[model samples]
Target: MKHPSQNSSPSLDNVYRIYWLLVALFVGRMGDLYVLLSRRASTLRTYAGDTSLPGGKRDPQDHNIELTARREAFEEIGLPLDPQKVPLLCILEPFLAGNSLIVTPVVVLILDNTLRPILNTPEVTSLFSHPLISFLHSEPPFATEPEMLEMKYHTYDDVSSSTRPGKVRLHRFMTGRETGGTKPIFGLTAAILIRVATIGYARAPDFEVNAPGQPSQEQRIARALKHDPIFREAAALEGIDPGRIPEPSALRRQVRTRDKRRARSKL
Candidate 1:
């Protein structure tokens, strides 16, 4: 399944270069499908006061992203993830964060739901989780369509002038049963979850299909992004021309037709 936003990410050439050293892991409880998440410490500067999956920068001791994710999960939450029990589901499409770090999301499914997260204070302030069904249900928890929120950055030597008044689509994976201030997920996290819901949980994805007749999944995703400012802005950030931001309608149709052709071929 295609992720929420991979096509039109911004160019981070001028931004600070941290390399591919960071990773996040979606740790799912096998039976209930609840994914673990941590609330970033208020003391931190970057992505401060945001909720995110468990992960950290890749250490020199780590060989790959999988190791990095496992290590980070343990360090951040003290969740001892047995490599044999908590199996890696997939490596999501890598993306560049606003901070200029290229991040890789490692999806892992754990055997039990009895998770007692010990937050590594200062890095993580708290812990919480919502079921995958909440996102999949599409009625109460998360909207049928992703929500867009305006973004603004204090222009530093690294930031471009165009990024001002930046607007991005926020993925609100609210727990229908819980009430409080909304904890919205954005950018790479949103993109990864959208794909995870559809692929890992066997749930219908969240997107809008513009075609009149029955439209394929590809067409739906393309149409959804066409209306998503985040997608356009991200692509533009990548230094792609404005003309290349929103994908053309004809190309969406072409992709839909080709998908059908491949299906028929297999049949």
Candidate 2:
């Protein structure tokens, strides 16, 4: 209910110049449940890989930020939410991307899951939803400072609950890895988390990082490229050169086609 713009502290003014650039965000929440969509890169070559949310740059035709958020959600995730279904809560303060575009996130609530997502393979790979309560409960223990950024991580105390009563904790972390080093989920994701936490969600305490093991999701894809015969065959059929890294657009199309065929056969 708190507007992100109205809640901005004086300290944030030092880091970013507040521009009145209007970009909209759709915050789809069902009861205590919120919807967050994760996107996998069609290929490991794209800039934003394995990130969350359905959003993009604003279009000239958009009348307002709300429309832009709805349009992007439908285009990217195939979830066609009616404008009437999206209840406008409040506008968050605009955040700047590295590209210098000022992004305005518009928070909204979606009470039902009636619409099936027909993801735009060119951008999205998969869509999954988690309970808002879970997010409200799980705490990310560690934070990463990539290069020169001075981001801080904070811990939260427990709040009382009845259904699954326990203390809820939360920790903030950098989202992506650096260019020459390991990637972390920084940038947009970090910004979103910060906004959500500050807006109202109760923070959870931090936990220890899990032990490192096999190759990560991205690494697994890379390994498959080297060894998977199925991928090789698919690449050949598509007239794509396996030795050359495929463009994200081309790879996404192939994945979408494959997924569609699989879905039809199941039907």
Candidate 3:
């Protein structure tokens, strides 16, 4: 008997090709079960010590953003994500790194826990999984320099307003120190966490979620800007003033509103 979930008679002609090539954001559960990989050499750390989802830059060969994420996971952590195991849940804003690399994140649902992952020693030192709920726990603030950069956004006056107003936002990236002086997750990891928090909050019910000893998001961001090494490096690299980035909270709010509207449409 054919499984009902499998579309055996998939047709290309009926497929609607929406060329919406915007940066895609997604969320993935670390399988429903909690498991942690043994840490190899504690001394060797390159954003590989902590437990995290497997992901990386999108390769040019990927047919779509989803393919890019799946490929990277397989290569870095040795998890062969079956196509059937992943479902597209949401899209997030694009995150730009200091080096100008644009990242698109995709969230996936891991249906089973029996699959063992073979960690790539060169890329990943260990592998582990924790309940998504643990992310709510608070941790002490770590110290690091805050990063200042400019961000651009469009503002709409009203629902009926046709003209879109473009403005610059002063944005800040929190350093590892602000969290509790523990080794900070910065660069791509930090950016990924921001997107994850936004998506998680959107999907969660109205309730209070807190991290222990960690400062509020706003405060952490301020501290990051104060200690951001990139901001200083940029100044020396270009010999130009590394001013503060623009605040995109208004734009983020608009995006979240749009997400809610789309969610309503799905019902």
User: Tens-digit lDDT track for model 3 on 1-267?
Assistant: 112233344221112111111112223453232222222324555433443345554443556667766776777666565756544555554443332233455665555445566877766665533333322223312222333122111111111112212221222222222233232233344335444554555453122233233233343333233335543443333333435533345435655788899999999
Q: For residues 1-267, could you state the per-residue lDDT of candidate 1 as single tens digits?
A: 112244344233213232332122344536556666667787898778676777665555666668777888888887776866667777766554553345667777665546567778988887777665554543444333223222211111222224322233334444322234334554455545666676766757544211224333343334433444555454456554545434546766677788899999999
Worst 10 residues of 1 by lDDT: 152-161
Q: Which candidate has the top score in TM-score?
A: 1
Sort every candidate by lDDT, greatest first.
1, 2, 3
For residues 106-222, what per-residue lDDT tens digits would candidate 2 score against the true structure? Answer: 666654456566877867666655333333333323244464245333233333323221222222332323333323434454445555544556554234221223222233344
TM-score per candidate: 0.58, 0.46, 0.43
Which whole-number lDDT from 0 to 100 does residue 50 have in model 1? 74
Using lDDT as the yardstick, the better of models 1 and 3 is 1
Clash number for each model: 9, 18, 35
Ranking by TM-score: 1, 2, 3
Which portions of model 1 miss their true places by more than 4 Å? 1-31, 113-115, 141-168, 175-182, 209-265
